[model samples]
Target: MAVHRALAGICLLGLLLCLSSSPAARAASKPDYLILTLMWPGSYCASTQLTEKCCKPTNGEPAADFLVQALETYDSTTGKPVTGCSRSCDFKILPLVNMLDDLYTYYANLTCPSNSGMPHWKDVWCTYGTCSSLNQSLYFDRALRLREKVKPLVNLGSSGIIPHATKSYSLEDINDALVPRIGFSFTVVCTRNYILWPFFYDDYLSQIRVCVSSDGRSIIGCPNGRESNCGDTVKFPPVSYPVSSTVIELPSGDEMAL
Candidate 1:
């Protein structure tokens, strides 16, 4: 009986060690932060050639620029992304009703055209959001609030990289446009969809992701391994709003004001 008990204890220790070494375990331990990955609607439309898969314009003039696409979490030290940490999303009480409209507007499920914003929000929550120290309301609400803070289009336009045509922009020019205004530097990366995106262009602006601290307030840099892979000369495409005819104006809608 003594020998058997010792064997069982050893087996338990081994099992614990094995589980601790996993990606999920390692990801859970380190300092974690929320990552906001914004996608250009124009680039998505142009690259995939799927104009129908875009979020439809509502309320006022279409937002034809960088739109909030994804919210994920990763380790702050290692820059390793950790997702799907648990099956449960902390969606105990449903989010604020007012946030639902803001969600559909900013956090639209462009990839999943048939569905609403819940899948995108829920998936993000179930994966990275759940892993965070933040609760469901805090997690989702923070995204809406963060959106209010970061507006790259307005800054970039002011820097003379206006949304008109695909221009080859230096890395310095892009960063110069953002850092001064937003007060935080961003990682400018490009799509790996070489076949989908034309070779006539260099890497196009895929995502301008910013890392927010664990408290979900301050912005931090992306993790070490997750730095930008974009070349110096990147194609900054024109912001395209899938429109019937045309309207040229900054996004001026009451929905945006809120």
Candidate 2:
């Protein structure tokens, strides 16, 4: 009887170890929510300094709209980014070739030392993409599709929040315009206008962060809640480009890669 109990204990321990070490277990350990970060081109360019290079794509200037910045995975419990899942990045461009046109149009690299936006895409894939349950192709495809579904420009414009050089809109109005249309709350991010230094320091609408389910299909309320540093009123500036490339060090952070 004692021998039988010992053998049973060993068997149960082995079974537990096998299940815990499986691929499914590894995937389950990852975060189950994603944040789709969308950046407004007008605000991005307007916040730039003369030293900071903000160029239009060689192909042409992308539409005056909100561009896909990143699709980041975040911990639902702690509301922090999940990264460095795989030690080996193993990023390849071949799988993303078909989507290059849409990528360039919607997610182009505006900063100086620009290539085909591959470096930026590669960085994102290696960082956040590897952390998700998606391959390189599926990750980029998902972000693009989400951007299409959340037609931010159309949603905001319908609410009479189109970009203007001199016009400013209240933060409340901006939230009201987006939350109902998106079916979920989002974080309104803003950047300080460096162009108008000490004279008139104003915040410009920079990025909108919408949360999505792990499957990357349905929009979900951000676990982090709607957080913003925007003032009472924020400007929505017009998009413009420098004829010559102005050079400055690129900003760091997963969201500022664009």
Candidate 3:
């Protein structure tokens, strides 16, 4: 009987040790801030056929130039060479899920935050928060964590929420959010007009961007202005089917102010 008891105790100790040493055991339960800002029509691309200094939509400026300039924040420690980015006119292309996943992983692993020593536009800038902020990687990490947690929660491949290549994921397809803190606040531009969108079937222009709260609990639209319900609460179910693209704007002339 005493030997049996000792054997049971040893098994229990081993179990505890295994759990404590696992990554899931030490994983972050919640972080202070989480953010994700998605660009629209995917992002801009420059004309490959043009060599002239000036060109219209057919051979115009790239969109990445405008996006990088507007956001002014990126991972300073790590960056990749960006090409065909301008303001005049550019291609708006959406990357496949695999490509996007690579980017997210790379950003999450960066160690430095300084903008100096960067190559060309590869330098990362800070917008709402500084690059040297504590757990800057938290934002990126959280995105990864969320993706893992939400993967089994829903069916992303055939559910029609995002590209089929996305097997396991979390957060909206527009932006990836991960952080170490519990709560935070900041503003980001909404590049796409999901509520009032154009190019309904196009792959690049389908998503939109909006300010996200730090906790990853809720999201509100329309940050600025004096309307009573400026950032009112709204909800959208999982994209399980095809839906109409046009929005009702204002329900056939209501008395509400524009």
Candidate 4:
């Protein structure tokens, strides 16, 4: 009985030590809001290089849909997007292996197709999760949890925002269309491309980013009147798979090799 009591005490001390050492255990001046950036695969693939492997259906993925690009936070005081807040701890994604299947298909880093394209999730976790109120494990788990809560893609798709077509949609019309489901102020950013030379054309419907509560529970209002880049009447064009010769650097210091 005495030996058992001593062992129990030792275990408790180890656990306490771990908690103290982890950033999530310590108090932090949390960010004002979370910016959930959802990437439209059609837009992403359109821009992705041919060398990069795009996210595929985890299990007969119904459609080439939206991917969670960056689950970031906005610093109200600094007026800039928060990134690389802390790197004191090494990121270990082994624990997240259980969700590997879903992560690859849903929030993929098409730039890095290796290891089922987990680097995308890793980049976001290491850069932003360290600064979050939750720990490493809970941070990712929360993202997955938050994603399951909304059905914006389906809602938008049902509202005639389908793939392989171009149509002009007004801001008010989109706001009303999504308010019923998303129930929050969100930002819809679009991408434009010009054929160049003899002619020029532009496209839209690149991304739809939504703001989440700090606690990661509810989809909240757009912070500081954050507005979309599109005009009052915007074009919703089909996703383009444009191959870029230049590589872009991700927030986690990762570069999408061209």
Candidate 5:
């Protein structure tokens, strides 16, 4: 009887070890989908209050178009973000040396105290990218590829939605421009320009959040459905800034305001 009990305990331990180390188990723990957030720099810098001071990259001017703000992971079943999946960040910039230019152009770190955008990349990789099935190189590469595929500015311009300081476009106008081109619905986020506050404020187009499949190949409707605080119309401001200008100093707020 004693021998049988000991053998049963060993079998249970082996089973647990096998389950914990299984590839299938690791894949199951990954997030169901990714949200590629493309932010409008003009609107991001226009706010009177900002959590991070905006600045141009030390390398050079970023592209005057929507930039990749974040590529976050979420669980469709729980409707919550999946973060801190791995303790081994082990991030190294050497692996990303080839794509540094594209990363600076599209996924820039405009935050104050501008340095190379390595810190921002590391944070994203440690927080969200580690949770993904992709390795570090593939993770950053995938985001860059997605940004190219979306082409937010080009699609919007094709539908007569060019940026203007004074012009405002309806939500429908923005949606029609992007959805058909991207072939999936996306959330258009807006922020109130508090720079002109106390007198008045304008809802400026901020970020566009699009859902991508786990494999990062095809676009899919956000499982949580469309989310927007935008009114009927929102201004599409031009991306104009002086070199090393003090763009914003908003009060403390959520990093992911979406």
Candidate 6:
């Protein structure tokens, strides 16, 4: 019994040490808002001179796996007990996975040949199932026919607006559609050593990148460009060229291949 108690104490101490050993650990020590940036289907992917893997469309299993891993990491690090990371009340990933899964199935069904002896999906009797009949040159044309079906997954849902409580505001409250000018915090998380957060804001503005999620409708970090003193809203998602082509220097005196 004494030996078992000592072993349990040692295990607990090891767990505590692991939780306090690094900046990432420290950042995860408390519950903070995690910014989840899903890679859009159209977004550029990393590539190498010898490999043209960049810009390739994600497959059915890979995308889902990536999302799951991201959510698990965020949950484990944040110490926040949440069921999942979807757009629902808790902003967990389950809903997003379900959305993408449905899309993948739809796309796969559309890829099937019409005369494959398989029953056609309801109301989908058009030229969709005949993708196999088209030539390579006509592939793009056929794919465009499915564009409307795939568009919703590409858009980032709105993060919504922060109201003054007394002021009347105009605009549909949706993510990516528009965010109001209000107090917010810009959070950046680097998953890999070389990854950098892509955002732009002037230091002169009254903005702070607090380590916690904005509780209300306040801007997550900074207001829109219309409120800029220079009068030109700073374009965000600050230019990302190929990381391999451009060089970036890390704060730790390490040069990145970017």
lDDT of each: 0.65, 0.79, 0.27, 0.63, 0.79, 0.25
Candidate 2 collision pairs: none
RMSD of 4: 13.1
Better of 4 and 5 by lDDT: 5
Q: Candidates' TM-scores?
A: 0.74, 0.78, 0.26, 0.69, 0.79, 0.24
- Runs in model 1 with CA error above 4 Å? 1-28, 48-62, 90-93, 192-201, 221-226, 241-258
The TM-score measured for candidate 5 stands at: 0.79
- Cα lDDT of model 4 by residue, 30-96, tens digit: 5777877777766655643355455443221223567677777766655466556674546766566
Better of 2 and 6 by TM-score: 2
Q: Mind giving the per-residue lDDT tens digits that candidate 3 earns over 142-229?
A: 4334333333213323344333222322333312231112112222222122333443311222222222334433442323321111
The deviation in Å at residue 126 for candidate 6 is: 42
Please provide, for model 6 over 115-230, each residue's C-alpha lDDT reduced to its tens digit, 9 standing for 90 to 100.
11112221121222111222322322223222332222232123322212122222222222322322232221211111233353221111112211222111233322212122
* Candidates ranked, most accurate by TM-score first: 5, 2, 1, 4, 3, 6
lDDT of 5 by residue, 1-258 (tens): 999999999999999999877655544655989989899998877766757467776654477788887788888887777876775667777677688777877888778887556678888988888887788888888888998889999999999999898899998889888988676558889987654556677789989998988877778878886668897889998987554433332212332121
Error of 1 at 162 (Å): 1.7
What lDDT tens digits, residue by residue, belong to model 1 across residues 13-69? 999999888766755655467787777766665565443455554322335667677
Q: Best candidate per TM-score, number?
A: 5
Ranking by lDDT: 5, 2, 1, 4, 3, 6
| Residue 40 in candidate 5, Cα distance off native in Å | 0.7
Candidate 6 has a TM-score of: 0.24
Per-residue error (Å), model 2, residue 33: 0.5
Candidate 2 lDDT tens digits, 170-191:
9999988887778755788998
In model 4, state the lDDT of residue 39. Answer: 72
Once model 1 is optimally superposed onto the true structure by TM-score, how far is the C-alpha of residue 53 displaced, in angstroms?
6.0
State in Å the error of residue 201, model 4.
Answer: 3.4
lDDT of 3: 0.27
Cα deviation of 55 in candidate 4 (Å)?
7.6
* After superposition, candidate 4 runs with Cα above 4 Å error: 1-30, 48-63, 112-115, 166-168, 196-200, 232-258
TM-score of 1: 0.74
C-alpha lDDT (0 to 100) for residue 136 of candidate 4: 66
